[model samples]
Target: GESVGLHLPTLSVQEGDNSIINCAYSNSASDYFIWYKQESGKGPQFIIDIRSNMDKRQGQRVTVLLNKTVKHLSLQIAATQPGDSAVYFCAEKKGSNYKLTFGKGTLLTVNP
Candidate 1:
């Protein structure tokens, strides 16, 4: 059986600090993982992605780490700012499937 979704987690951070959000996937067959950030009243936006073949991938002000051994994924945001506050989600897809299974999202709040 596969997990369809998860309970949302909340993360609070101070401005100028770093934030780390973690996600766990139930499907080990999933090869592609993507991170998305969604602001209030807006759709999810692409953040970063990593393949199972790679352990880590970096983007502007963001880093994604994948641990296939534990079916875990994490997103690290550098220099947390108020504008960076959003709900972040991790999505996984396997093979040629166009559908992505999304994990529980984490709401990040950056306080000044």
Candidate 2:
């Protein structure tokens, strides 16, 4: 099935550096967006989210931006640490749908 995907399959960054992960979604009608970070064994943990009505939202040490014009979404992490290394994914829900279509995970590697 068609779904969202990241431009880069993996991102490499140094510790304490700001990390920006970009995602491209094909569905313009998707009204809700979420970013998740998954550790090696755990399930995806919600990092941040944004509604279509808004352009941007922020959480602790993280920010999610929604660009409806280009169907683009990005998650920015501040002061990224080695502990922040994980696979990140973006999911989108269209209308009132309960199921979220997720993008191919982007592996973030933080070098010390």
Candidate 3:
């Protein structure tokens, strides 16, 4: 089976800084997209989503940009902090059931 993984399993940053998590996927036919923030020992929470028809979307303190041409996606967090430290994942809806294929994971380290 194919798998999605992050280039960096862990990322470190200082408080009040910006963080960027990158994801690379193999399935180019995937359609819908979503970014999730997961704290230690917790389930992932939806950050933002984008459809194949669009290229970018933004949310409070967060932004998601999809580049279908290259099969790449990224999540940008503004003013990252201790609370923002967590693992981030990028998922795509690849089937009729809207099944999500999640990237391995990225741990964000925010230094306060």
lDDT of each: 0.89, 0.94, 0.86
Q: Model 1 off-target regions past 4 Å?
A: 4-8
**Per-candidate TM vs. native?**
0.94, 0.96, 0.92
- lDDT by residue for model 3 (1-112), tens: 6656678999999999999998877787777888999998889999999887888788998988888787888899999979999899988887575578888889999998
For 37-92, candidate 1 gives per-residue lDDT tens digits of 99999999999999999999999999999888877889999999999999999999
lDDT of 2: 0.94
How many residue pairs in model 2 have overlapping backbones?
0
Worst 10 residues of 2 by lDDT: 1-10
Residue-pair clashes per prediction, in order, are 0, 0, 0
By TM-score, who's the top model here? 2
- Cα-based RMSD of candidate 2: 0.9
Report the C-alpha displacement of residue 90, candidate 2, in angstroms: 0.2
Model 2 residue 21 CA deviation in Å: 0.3
Question: What is candidate 1's CA lDDT for residue 97?
Answer: 95
Instruction: Judging by TM-score, tell me the better candidate of 1 and 3.
Output: 1
